[model samples]
Target: MGTDISRPEHPPLARRHAWSLAAYRHMLRKRLTGQPAADLKSIADKRWDIAPGEITVSPPAIYLPGQMERVTGWEGQRFYPYVHPGPTMAGGLSIEQGPTRGYLIKNVWLIDGALYKGNASHWLTLKPQRFAPVLVENEIERGAIYCTQNGNSWFGTWLMEDCVTYALACDEGVPVTSAPSARYPLFTQAPPYEDWLGMNPLRLRTAFFHQLVLFDDVSHNRSRHQRYRAMGDKLLTHVEHAPHPGVFILRGHEGDLRLLRNELEVAEHMCVKWGFRVINPLRLDVPTIIAACAGARVVMGVEGSQLVHGVNVLQPGGTVFTLQPPNRFISYYKYMTDRDGQHFAFVVGTPDGDGFTIDINEVERTMDLLPKH
Candidate 1:
C-alpha cells in the first residue's frame, strides 16, 4: 500500500480574524462535490395526488411483487394501506432516478410504528447510470415496509452505493430533504459469488445519527482493542460496560479471517487499557449494532464497515477516527464526512511508529467545531 496526500489541511491563516474569500471558495468546492447534492427541481415542484390517509409510499422499481406478497400477504392486493411502505427485502422496490419525475400517492395504511425507527425524513437517493432501470411506471403499490438486510458481503457495495446515490439525488432536488430511514443489512446473506467490482448503483437512506462517526479496520491489525480504548478514554465520556452491545466488524470474503484475528486482539487490548468491556453479539444484525452505536459517544476502528456503522450511529457533531493505509484510499474519510455533513478525520500509522497513534490535537480541534447536540 502506498500513501499520497489526497486532501490536506488548509494553509494556516496569517490573520485569523480577517475573513478570507479564498477559504470560502475552498469550502464551497468541498461542499458541492463532497456532500449529497442533486439537480432535481422538476420532481420537487410536482404535485402528486397524495391521497388522504396514505401514510407511506415509495417507487415501484426496487420492490418485487413476490417479496411484497410474502411480507404483507397481500396476494393480488390492489390498494396500499400506508403512506410509506415499510422496510422490505425485495431488491427492486425503490425510487428511481430521472429528470425530476412525478410523485405517486396511494391509499392510507398502518404499520408497526416501532419498526419505523430513526429520524423522520432521513434518506439519501442515488442515480445508477450504469445499471438497467429498475422502476416500472414510476409507481409502486404501497404495502408493509421492507428493509434490505444484506450489505456486508457480495451486494454490500451495490446496496451501499445505491443508498449513497439516492441521498445525493435527493440533495439535488429543490427544497432538498433527507430520507427518513437507511437500511443496512448483513453482507453474508448476499447470494454467493456476486461480482462486487464494477460501476455499482449507489443508494442512501435516512441515517440514525445526525452525524456519522466512521471507525475502520478494527480487527485486521494487532492489539486494536487496547489502542482504541486508550484513544476512547481520552475522547469519550461515560464509558460503560455493554454485556451484549451489538457491534458489527465488516470483513471481506478473502483474507477476512486474518483481519478478524487482528481486530479481536485490538479489542482485547482496549479492554485492558480502559477497563471497557467488549460485547460481541452472536449474530451480526445491523439494527441491533446501530442501536449500540447510537448509545456511544466515540467510535474508533480500522477503516471498514464498522466505520459505516459509526456513520449510522453517531450523533450530529460527533467525531470519528479510522486507520489509514500508508497510502491508498486516503480520501475515503474526506469523501464520507465532508459530503455527508459530519466531522471526519484520519490517522495514518507509520510502520515503525506506535501501533496506534491518533493526532489528538487534530481530534480535539475537530471536536471543538462540532455542533452541540
Candidate 2:
C-alpha cells in the first residue's frame, strides 16, 4: 500500500539553466494569454552575495503533485481534482501553491518561514523545500521577517517536524535573524518555536547554527512520536482530571463523503454505549487533541487530515479503523500507520446515492476484528 516518494536531486548547472529557459518560455506563454507567472524565478538556481559555506545550497523548485491513480489509486474516488494547475493569480499577482505547476520559490530566508496548507501539502511540499543552507530571519530584529498568506488550514503542520527545521538550521551555523512576525500567532500557540526542539528560543534562532537535517512525514519515525508523546505527557500534567484511558471515536465534521445521513448519529450512539469517547477534533487544539488520543488504545474516524492526529497520539501497536468513502479510498494514512507499527484497517461503507453510509454493525465487526493487546 506504499508508493515511492521521489526526492528532488540538484541537477547539473547546464540542465538547471535549460530548466530555467524552459520555465521562462512557459511563463511567457502564460503571460501572453494574461495568466499569472509567479514561479518563473523558481525554475533556476540562484546565488546570493553570501559565501559558499554561509549559504550552502541552490535548490530546485520543488513541485509535489496532487494524488494520482498511478501513486495512490484513490484518485478515482475524488470528486474534484487534487490540485488545480495554471497561474494562481490572487489580486493580479501570482501566488505560490506547490504541487501544482508554475509554483516556484528561491532564496527563501530560513528565519521567517512561509506556511502552505491543506491536506499533507505543508510538510510534503513547503517543508522539504526549506532543506537548504541560508540565513534564517529569527536572528534579526523583531519586525524583519517577511510573511505571506498562501493557502487555507494550517491545521497540525506546526508540530515536531516543523520545529526540527529550525533545529537543523541552527546546527548548520547559518546566520539566523531574531525577527518575529504577526503570523507566528496563527502558526502556533507557543511563544518561541525553539521550545519544541528543547532549545532556548532566543539563543537558538539568534545565533549561528552548524547542522543541517531532513525528515519524512511524522508517522514514518517512531522516535519522533516518542518525543511528541513525551511532550504530550508533560502538557497533560497541567490538565486536572483529563479523560480516562479508553477507545476514541473521532467524529469528522467536514468532507464531501462525510459521516452524515444519520450515520454519525448511529455511530455516536453505539460509540457511547460501547465505552468510546466521541471527539470532534475541530473543536480542540493540537495539545488537547493529542492528550486525548495518547491515552486511547483504539482510534476510529473517517479518513482525512484530522485522522493524522490519531496516528500522532495513538501508541505503537494501536488500532486505527478508517472509514473509507466508496471510490475515494486513499491509503496515505494506512501507509503511515503501518510504518509506525499500528494495526491499520478500513471498512468501505455502502454508497448511499452521491455519498455513503456505514451500518453500525460494520463498526461492531471492526471493533471485534481488532487485535487484542
Superposed Cα deviation of residue 9, candidate 1 (Å):
48
For candidate 1, report its TM-score: 0.33
Q: Model 2 over residues 39-126: C-alpha lDDT tens digits?
A: 3223323312111111111111111122122122253222111322111101122222112111222222222232111111112122
User: What is each predicted model's overall lDDT from 0 to 1?
Assistant: 0.29, 0.39
Per-candidate TM-scores read 0.33, 0.50
Write the residue-wise lDDT of candidate 1 on 1-373 in tens digits: 1111111121221221111122233335546767532322222322332111111222111111232222222111211111222232211333221121223212211111111111111112222112221211111121112122122222423233323223222222211112222232334522221121111121122111111211111111112222322322322233333332223243322322213224455455545543323444225553344445544444555555445544443443454545433322223333333323345444343332323333334334433443444
Q: Best TM-score goes to which candidate? A: 2
Model 1 error, position 353 (Å): 15
